[model samples]
Target: MKSSMATPVTVSDITENPHKYQFKQINDMTGQSILNSFDAVFISNSVAFNGGLNVLKDSIYHETINKDMRYNINIIKTAKKNENNKELKKLVKLFHSKEIQEYVGKKFDHKKVEVKKQVSYLK
Candidate 1:
């Protein structure tokens, strides 16, 4: 006759039990600075490509994995209709301008994300 033993469970084993785990959401600055504190850190391409990690010494390694992140320019109909919204309209127009697009392209790595043609909605 042999005695039977039970297997020990881990945090992953209790997937359905919310109380078994502790969760905390840290700001981007803290989270990026402390990569070793967690198993993994996830970030958007804009952050990664724009030298967000340049502040840290060569303690971390990164790779560029292409992701589809669409950038858009939108204006609310109500804002467009209001005559007093000249400033808002001016800002929107600037966003659609070629100069602004070029600036954005330079700001964010153009190789990863491209600025497509601007779309306008006229009444």
Candidate 2:
């Protein structure tokens, strides 16, 4: 019989979670540089493997396909701009609220009538 659910935790799953996974600062820089150098070497080797310098004359094309990648940058930018405008409007309304205006000695108007603050009596 097959198991209903496999083990929830996996090594790859743990590595991908930013909150749980962290790289050492030293290792991050050094490892990245090493990886970059290796990538450069690989590129050099790949070119050398396929007829050294003659591959460029044929106009050979090499494409790296990333099926998982999707970009909606325009949508994100538009959404942010819209949200910021909404937040600004909310702030303006908050500052214009009755309690806030009173603190700043500002008066409210309605029907060409101004409401005056009632004087507090001391007992």
- Locate the minimum summed-lDDT window of 10 residues in model 2: 67-76
- RMSD each, Å: 13.6, 25.2
lDDT of predicted model 1? 0.47
lDDT of 1 by residue, 77-117 (tens): 34446756878778767876889778866654343333333
lDDT by residue for model 2 (68-88), tens = 111201111234457568766
Q: What's model 2's TM-score?
A: 0.19
Candidate 2 ranges with C-alpha deviation above 4 Å:
1-84, 106-123
The best candidate by TM-score is 1
lDDT of each: 0.47, 0.33
